[model samples]
Target: MQAEIGLIGLGTMGSNLALNIAEKGHDIAVFNRTTAKTGAFFEAAGALRSKIIPCTTLEEFVGAIRPPRPIILMINAGEPVDDQIEALKPLLSHDDILIDGGNANFHDTIRRNLLLDGTGLNFIGMGVSGGEVGARHGPSIMVGGAQASYKRVEQVLLDISAKYEGQACCAWLGENGAGHFVKTIHNGIEYADMQMIAEIYGIMRDGLGMQAKEMAPVFAGWNEGRLNSYLIEITAAVLDTEDAETGKPIVDIILDRAGQKGTGRWSAIEAQQLGIPATGIEAAVAARSLSARKDEREAAEKAYGALGETLKRDAGPLEDLELALLAGKIAAYAQGFAVMSGASGDYKWDLPLPEIARIWRAGCIIRSQFLSTIAEAFEGAEKESNLLLVPAFVEMMSEAQAGLRRVVARAATAGLPVPALSSALSYFDMYRQGRGTANLIQGQRDYFGAHSFERIDRPGAFHGPWAMNAG
Candidate 1:
């Protein structure tokens, strides 16, 4: 099949992705609400622009592309996706492909897939990451849908993706919603990672009284170490630059209000629904919410007055603390993955978690050295669902839990809000502890309702009033 792609919504990510495809020598038909944006891409790409057909109307966009046409939707998630699908439905035929390349709720993706099933239109939920720059270059792509449909466009996707061990950055992440689910959790992990960096920044600024410029080298140095990641590397660059207008640090002058498009929140909510504790991801969500409430927090702080002294800079080694934080973050990510894995089982997607982790190692915001370890754990597992109990990961968590606890304690003492990271660590501790307060509540329920509690010894067998009376 000759590669001809159609892209809707010519925003930052979309325009870049479209340009990347065009640069790679594929015919691309681009559309935007405002036709001017499409022209901007044409002018920027110049002579290579002939490869792209700019369309203003939905009908024109659909008509311009070839049959079995692959349309990449880069619009905002939620209603915009629905609106685009509805608008495009009339123009599409059987066996046509629609790819959502935005941060959308996985459940919605599953719902949309089911809706389009008999219509003969194939829906692909793709998790695209690497931000604007990565989109223009090559970003890690996670795709989930019909394998046959994936195979048809695999080469095109590969051509536009970042490389990994001679394998394409794109993978058939399973059926229906798996791609978006992995992406959702990816954003969740991203939330935790960013919050961890922020916490580190807080420690550096508040504890060490180091300026952003002074801390930039420390992060840059860490980037060369195991802590090296896209986020950390970029953060160092961000720290190095200053705003010309403010003369103050660029980062400091920027507003504390963090923006979200609800993917992280969706992941956390889905985890709760699936009975999975995604504490790290949830903490990240909470951290963003807290960031949005800067005024409220300031008021509360002012009312409380001076509470305590600054943290004493101990001459102790921070290697253990860093290790513990890394482990806790890893556990949090594992828990989030487990939630998605469980959803896959229930949704019948049969997603390969190892591949999901491996693909996330580059071009994605949450890309980190830690994902390699996760991929290893998933690879060694007898079953995909057995990721959390993998021996190496378990050992790593065990080694780091103590340090994580200490770090959380220190943060709390310093009156710093490390909600996301701390919550993730707490969730990890609770998951591994083998006993939680919830179990006590369950015991109470069994005692009151004759709900038939199983002894730890008996395991799966249920015991009720009949067994008690007989005994």
Candidate 2:
């Protein structure tokens, strides 16, 4: 009963996280359904094994932790989480805290919290980002629960989180579902980011007639500037790597189809339901769906005739592609944050936008130099203003949007697919406009459905009596 924290599930993430905690000098109790896993972990733990108490059974695991315990669940999401909660609750006392560190749907977090209302068990829905290696080292941690409940394990979380400029990339974002909601939206932005990069790569491949080796240097160069990020760094490595057996770029050997595990789609669906226009994410998800329909694409290619090996190479003035990528990134972040802002207000979360930006500065898939700029913008702006309206970002958009316009136009004429970039450009354009063409939509709805439209000269809704006299 000397362990400070107890963890269940011995999956890759769970095992690595348990090792991290133990190496951090915290006495932790670990349990897996299979006893052999627990045995193997201790054998591999080396010097850190002394701090880890491996229990063969759940009951033994529960008894190993001290009072006012914090039990973390790093299992699969969906029904597994719900089922595990029911199984573990009987073993936990009223003062215990259960933390879900998996990528969960926020609504499910809210529902679970609601279900455990008076049970006296504290539920913390935490979003742990960065992949397997990050879990073993330090990942950005987003916590959503009561302040008191967060306080109980704050030090441990901070200690295990990645640091950016001497600050921990971890914080309590809000209460119930807020953390997972932020993570879902983060994945949404990640989708847009990856897709935009892939679209740019498509241009380099088809339009420029450049190989992966040629493009690797380009991505590497971008990493030295404002676009420097984990994704960019990794993209360079991935593209530059050659398949040893085939003697070709590894990327060329890989399948064109992209795989997704729901978070990106969920974010897009959530944004649509919330009536927040996250078009970049939406376009990215759609692009993935298009990629997945391989047979249909093959049939279409056969019917339409494939566009030969080399494009005419006339997508000129492409020196500003970096600027275009930057602009698209800004648009994606702007849309994502807007969705977050809407959710914050709708759910009364009062999420710390600046803090969110700060935490995202490191240890996350989207970590970048641009995040510091975002943090500064949020720190200086009125809470009601969008990122595009921030002074510095306004200047960025003013300078960069012209380049974005040029790139999108060139890609379009070159017959290159740039859906994410094109959609991002459109979103930015729509956001800054005072008047839009939706007035025609209003008129059409009124004419057909008698929905009525508001008049600029008058206060009330009005309908045209265009055919009354003739009828």
Candidate 3:
């Protein structure tokens, strides 16, 4: 069947995604704030230009696409998404599909879905990942909206999405904002993983006194082991490169500071409001902030020279035990997913946690072998809520606990900060511990306010007489 897709932005990602769709035999109509951007796409696609019609106005763009028009918005995440939706509404008919393909805040998505309820326009909060190249080829897509609305456009999405074992990369995540919520947490986990990789790089470099070139082989070897992943594989490539002119290692020459676009921070903030522990994500954000303090760190390093000692290498090979590190990383990812699970429960989204893990096994940043285990954790559980308590994950945590302790202790002893990795282990420990010190504070609340508390000795009741009198 012929499908006509409208693209409202021709930025790097939009342009590439449009091309990918066109290449897949679907016709695409392009529109942009700047007409020139759309023109460039038309010129670049050449003969494929026949598949893409550039429109000067949103009205013309909407008019050009087929009925029940599926328009994908690839604009900036926040206010810009709002602006585009407002501009497109008057031009769109009821029951038309509006897909937000940007990194929009999930809360805003929830509000927008409600706002468009009476308009008959279907709004889908879609999380598209894999970046520009992924767009040009295939990316992992997370969609959240009415199931019927998702079914309406699933074919088009499937054609453009990266396939994994014959399943479409696209899945109906849940209702309303669920898609973007998963994406937000996906990005949060991404931040943690990237920071952890950087920490490992730092440990190998500063702590081990290994050059970037020297480190490439180690990473490459690790990639062949249980720690194998796209990130580790790419890290090997990153370590191998050197500046042609300066003959200095590329990684060493690059700036120490890292930049963030705010999604990770937003995830942490949401976790706090929801009373969920997102320690891995929080550490990732902290790692970025620490990166921004390069000058202060350099100064301190100079002032405290010789006081710091280098890391001592482990006596023997850890080849057989690399699964320990892998297991800890899996627990970190599980904790991140647990945060999303909590948010979904609170929002009444009914998200499919198992499918989320399955879709994430490819295209996305956290795509790793461990995700299969996470998917199994959800599937084997009696209820979806039991994912964290699954036997496999619990066993993985148990196996990794000692290695995590050793890694954290070694990093501390060597004066190296492994914030993301360390915090991930801490989160795993805390989750398994089940009981928290915060209950002491809750006890104090009952003591002072006469608030009801569940009696450890018996059951639930109002504890203090003074609290009952105050009430």
For model 1, the run of ten residues with the poorest summed lDDT = 315-324
Residue-level lDDT of model 3, residues 1-471, one tens digit each, is 223888888889999999999999889888999988777778999878778888888778888988989999998988898888888888888789999999989899999999999888999999998788778888889999988999988988989888778776778889999898888888988887788778777766767777888878877887886677777788889899988989998888899899998889888888898887878789989989888998898998789874366766663214212433565567557667778888878988878888888888777767777677777777773754534577776676676667667766777788888887788677766766767787777778887765667766786575665565654
The number of clashing residue pairs in each candidate reads: 1, 0, 2
lDDT of 1 by residue, 350-460 (tens): 878888888877777877777778788777737545445777676767776677777778778877667766876776666667666776666666666666666767668
- List the global CA lDDT of all models: 0.80, 0.89, 0.80
**Which pairs clash inside model 3?**
95-120, 450-467
Question: Could you estimate the TM-score for every candidate?
Answer: 0.91, 0.96, 0.91
What is the TM-score of candidate 2? 0.96
Model 1, residue 23: distance off in Å is 1.3
The better candidate by TM-score, 1 or 2, is 2
RMSD of 2: 1.8
Order of candidate numbers by lDDT, starting with the best:
2, 3, 1
